[model samples]
Target chain A: MVQFLQQIVNGLSLGSIYALIALGYTMVYGIIKLINFAHGDIYMLGAYVGFICTVQLGLGFFPALIIAMVTCAIIGVVIEKIAYKPLRNATRIAALITAIGVSYFLEASTQKIMGTSAHSFPDVLGTQTFNVLGVVISMKQIIIFVVTILLMLLLQYVVQKTKIGRAMRAVSVDADAAQLMGVNVNATISYTFAIGSALAGAAGVLVGIYYNTVSPLMGLVPGIKAFIAAVFGGIGIIPGAMFGGFFIGIVETLVTGYGSSLYKDAVVYIILIIILIVKPAGLLGKNVKEKV
Target chain B: MKKLVIALFVFAMLAGCSSNGGGNPAGDGYKIGLHYELTGEVADYGNAELEGSKLAIKLMNQKLGEDKYESVEYDNTSSTTEAVTISTKLVQDGVIGVVGPATSGASAATYQVLDGAGIPVISPSATANNVTQKNPDDENSEVYNSVFRICFEDSYQGAAMAQFAYDTLNAKRVVIYGDSTTDYAKGLTQAFTDQFHKLGGTVVATEYYVAKDTDFNGTLTKIKDMTYDALYIPGYYNEAGLIAKQARAMGIDCPIIGGDGFDSTTLVDLAGATALNDVYFTTAYTTVGASDALQAFIDAYKAEYNKEPGMFAALAFDATNLLMEACEKAGSNNPADIQKVLVDIEFDGITGSFSFDATHTPIKSVLVVELVDGVQASAVSVSPKM
Candidate 1:
């Protein structure tokens, strides 16, 4: 039981990172109906930025994290404007292809610059483990959970209570109607990208601390997994992505802890298939009739 | 349209007439082929070889001048097909001998082609048994005539470490985490497992992961309940370092051992000082050394490049000098003569003294290097009897 609880602690720590990245995927999908494949690379960029801030610029962990989030938010807005905005009226497939292109572009360019080698991410969260009820948890794991929950609450408050949030919701409902209501459609879309990218950036810094290593291609697998998390919980739903991230994380950790790790990815995909079979719109998604 | 076609044909002819650097040399200098990875996956090792070999060539040129060597350089970019192109290009350009593609796959690709051409090709560090030994099962099988290497074969390293683990570290039960993608990793894994069992050590479990995987907590957790005295991971430094870090984080205290994959400076940095405790690996040479000859080479390398020479540098230096020595012994730069001379020559190097065994691989002692306080320190030297 202690071992099981310990695995849950590991799962939560891992899941929070996925949750943060999944929020980005879910938000962009919510606003534009486009899956931003480069969202994962944004997380990678955040880690790199944080690395530079702390290592070369000699800033504290929190300062580096904030700097990375701001930098990524700006980058996210620019990427949406450049890559997706022009293709707004085009087919969804085209936008997805561009997102994938952007993802590869970020990976290749970073590999060219950084030389495809791993860098040791500085230890920000001190190396200390605390025992609670026979289960030991690291300091970084605690930070991941607390920060992720706080950010999710803040995100919920922003979307529910703010004017921009209302505009975002209106745009997601009907872009033409939102434009008629004077919502400034382009600005709302850009705001969505900024928020999503900032969340991904924060996740990137936290993951770098937990993993203690960073590489150019570090975002690829995690990005795919986070996307899976987003889809596993209704893709465009806010609460769903968060719940899905934690769920996948816990399931993955438990599977590896008690079962064969070679089948972890296979098991995750199988669960997703079962979930989709039962609820075609995702776990929390409503079945809505649409014009074909 | 006719005039444009004629003009294009003339331009193409003129482009082909241009001379590349290192293809031609004035006076009585020998033209050697510099075949190493300059811009690919293993470019770091290739770059080190280039630096060390270039330094050796420069110093040799200072003494020989006009009889100094000019090299036609080819960067394989760590691909076998690219190695073929470069090997052919080197041969067509008339190099006396070749000094490295820096990896077993690259060497395997080009060595047969170079051997067919009867050119002597020496690899700085390709360790796979088939790299030097074309016929593995036969005791008296003829060695690959034109192919030779300065590093010990793959089997030697794994066997040495296995002996060290049983006799020195006193390990009994082991778990192996092998990289299933590469022949290098697979070969080391097989060799280590065979030797370990031969020495009465039971392998508890074997796990495999592909390269580029950073997450191993899954594997760590799976192995947590299993009983194992040591972890033998046969793979590169990146994943090895990550495994060590994850293993420690999961509260596993068993000593981790591996082959030459854990040699890089990045291993210490990635694993940290505390995580690296009791981590050991076998490699060509110990980085922490103070021998007069080794120190002289190190000092000279540091003076020239403002950095300590990695093992690749030392190996490439030996390869370069070995090529030069063979050329001198043969009294000509002819491929046939150089190949003939190398078959019987013994060269002493900074890594260790070695001559070609029946397999065309150098016979040398493999060092069991251990990580102490995150710094690579020499642990023990194992001489192979098999």
Candidate 2:
């Protein structure tokens, strides 16, 4: 039971990172209906930025996190405007392909610049562990939990209690109707990317600190896993992505802890299949009736 | 417009002809392919091996009093498919033999492609057991007769470590956390487990992770509750370093032992100095107790590159020298001739003096290097009791 609890602790730390990245995937899908495959690479860029902030610039963790988030937010807005905007009217598949292209471009360009090697993220939070009821938790894990919850709450306030948030919901529901009702759809979409990418960037910094290693290709697997989490919880649903991230993280950790690590990915996908079979929409997603 | 198109086409042909004219001078030397990971995740290993191979070639040329060898080099970027592509290009360029693609995965890819073309290929650090022969566990497995290596195979190194852990360190139980995605790690794991069990030491738990995986805390937490005397990680420095850091951070301060994959400066950078205490790994060569010949090679390498040469450089130097010696013995730069000579040749190298056994693996000694406070303290030579 202690072993199980310890695994859960590990899972939560990993899941919070997935949750942070999943938010970006869900928000962009909610607003523009594009999958934003490059969302993961943006998270990777955020980690590198954080790496520079802490290692080269000699900033503390909070400052590095904030700067990384801000830098990624601008990059997110620029990517949407330049890459997705041109193909807005073309085809959804076209935009999706462009997102993939953007992902590759970011990875290749970063590799070309930084070289393909892993960099050790500086240990800003010194190692400290706490034992509660035979379970071990580290200071880094606690920071991850605190940061993720705060960001999620801040995201909740932005989505529910702000004018821009209402505009975002309006665009998601009916872009043409929202435009007719003076919603400024393009600006709302850009804001959506900004907020989502900022969350991803924060996740990146957290992961760098937690893992103590960063590389150019670090975001690829997490990006796919987070996308799966978003879909498992109900893609395009704000609360669903958060729930899905934690759910997948715990399940993955438990599977890896008890069962074989080889089957962890397979088990995650199988659960998704079962969930989708029961409710075509995700666990937190509502089934929308199709209109012809 | 048609006339203009024809004129442009003619101009392009002329440009291509001029570029082709600036190629290698005819019959100046024999072209030996140097395919390696020049710029990728394992670029450190590749570039070091390249330097060693270049140094060997320089000395070989000076001895022969002429440029009897020329390197046709290509960077595989630490990719298996890229290694295959480079092998095809090397074959097309009429190279006699190829020397690299340092890691086992890429070396395996090149061997599969080059074996069919009857090219004699040598890998400096592709230590996986099955690189020369397929299905090392099976007796009837096919062998890549033309493929060979300079360093001892992974099984030898793995067994050596297991023996050291049991006999020298006096550990009765060990837990293995290995990389499952690479043949190198799998080979080491298999040999270590078999040898440890044979030595009457119990293996507590065996956990696996793929390359690029950073989160071992979940798995580590599970293993923490288990009873184990030592932990053996059969993987590259990237994941091993991270595991060392995490393991130490968790206060699981038992000794950690590994194979040659842990021989990299990046290991120190990744794990940090404080976390690397009581770590041990098997390597091909060490400066701890160097022979005069080995020290000479080290000094020459230092004088040439102004940096300490790692194990990869030493192995590649030996591999290049071995190949060039075969070429000289065969009295020709023919792949078939070089392959025939290699099968029956005995070579002396900085790493050791050895001849290839039936499986094309070198019968040589391995150094088990230990770290004290994250710095190399001592290396003791050990032979696996196979």
Candidate 3:
């Protein structure tokens, strides 16, 4: 039972990271209907930024995290403006393909700048472990949970209460109608990217601190897993992304702990397949009519 | 305008051809190919090999006139497909032989092209047994005739580490965590498991992970519940270093053992000194205690590159000089003659003095180095009882 509880704690910590990244994918999808494959690279960029801030500039963790978030937010807006905005009226596939191209470009350019090697992220918070009921939990894990929950609440307030959030929802529901209603669709889209990418940036910094290392290609797997989490919970639904992230993380952890680690990835995909077959729309997704 | 464009295109084509030594009237050197990973995942290993090969080539030219030999270099980008493409280009370039594509997967990927072209290819550090043998799992598997390596096969280090753990460290119960994606790690894991079990040590658990995986908390948490005397990770320094760091953080402080893949200095960088305590890894060379010849090579390397030469550089220096020795023994640059002489040549290198076995793997000693606070404290030479 203690072992079970330990695995649960591990799962939740891992899940929180997936949740942070999934928020980015789901947010972009909610606003523009583009998958934004390069969102993961933005996360990678965030870690490198945090790495520079802490390692080179000798800043503390919070300052490094905020700076990384702001830098990534600007980058997110610029990427949307340059890469996706021109293809807005074109086919969705074109925008998706361009996102992939952007992803490769970011990976290759970062590899060139940083060189093909992993760097140790200096220990920002010294190691501290606590045994609660024979289950070990670290200071890093506690910080991850606190930060993720706080971000989620902040994201919810912005999405549900703010004017820009209303404009975003209005545009997602009916862009033509929202434009007719005097909503700045372009501004809303850029704002969505900014917010989403900021969350991803925060995830990058937390992961760097948690794992104690960062590399050029660190974002690839988590990006895919977060995308899966978004789809599993119901893409374009903010609450669903959070639920999906936690679910996937816990399931992956439990599978790896009890069953074969080799089959853990396979199990996640199988659950996704089952979810798709049972309800074409995700767990929290609703059916919507498509215009031909 | 169209006529001018056509004329310019023709001139550009001529320029391209001429630049490949096609139009150089004074070209008389025997061109050898240096196909290595200059960029991408394993670029560190490839770059070290490049430095070693360059130093060896410079010395070789001084010994046997400047125009006697020359090398054309290409980067395989530390990828298998890129290796195949580069090997094909080397064949078309009509080089005598090639050295490198540092990892086992990339080196093995070049076999079909180099084998059919009858080119004798040598790898400086490819350690998977299958790179030189047809099927290393089978006892009677034939050797890959033209493919050769200067380092001992993966099984040698794996078995050596197991024996060291059992006999020296007195470890009876061990856990195995390894990278599943590469033949190099898989080969080491298999040999370690077999040898440990043969010596009557109980393997507590066996786990696997793919390359580029950053998290090991779930797996480590599971392993913490089990009883083990030591942990053996058979993979490159990239993942191994992270594993060591995570394991130490989780409070599992047993002695960690590994293979030659853990030879890089970057291992210390990834896993800090505190985390790397009580770690031991098997390799073909270490600078802890060096022979006079190796000391000379180290001094020369530091003078040239302004950095210490790692195992890959040392082994690649040996591989390049050994190739030149074969060329001299054969008395020609013919690939077939070089292959014949390579089989019988007894070249003394910084790593050790050994000739290639039937499978083209060097019969050499494996050194197990112990780390104290991320510094090499001791290295004991051990021969695997095969």
lDDT of every predicted structure (CA atoms): 0.83, 0.87, 0.86
What 10-residue stretch in candidate 1 chain B is worst by lDDT?
A: B18-27
Show model 3 residue runs off by greater than 4 Å.
Answer: B1-30, B38-44, B55-71, B134-142, B296-309, B328-333
lDDT value, residue A262 of candidate 1? 54
Least well predicted 10-residue stretch by lDDT in candidate 1 chain A: A108-117
Please write out the lDDT profile of model 1 over residues A182-256, one tens digit for every residue. Answer: 899999999999999999999988888888787777888789889889999999999999999999988988877
For candidate 1, give the lDDT of residue A150.
95
**Candidate 1 per-residue lDDT over residues B224-331, each given as its tens digit:** 778888999998877888889889887899899998778776787788888888888888777676578778788889899886677788888889989988898889
Which wins on TM-score, candidate 1 or candidate 3?
3
Candidate 3 lDDT, A1-292, residue by residue in tens: 9889988998999999999999999999998899999988889989998999999999999999999999889889988887899999999999999999888767756665676667889989888889899998999999999999999999999999999999999999988899999999999999999999999999999999888778878888899989989999999999999999999999998998999777778898898899889876789999887979
| TM-score for all models, in order of appearance | 0.83, 0.89, 0.91
Standalone chain B TM-score for every prediction: 0.88, 0.86, 0.88
Better structure of 1 and 2 per TM-score:
2
- Count of backbone collisions within predicted model 1: 0
Q: Which ten residues in a row have the lowest lDDT in candidate 3 chain A?
A: A108-117
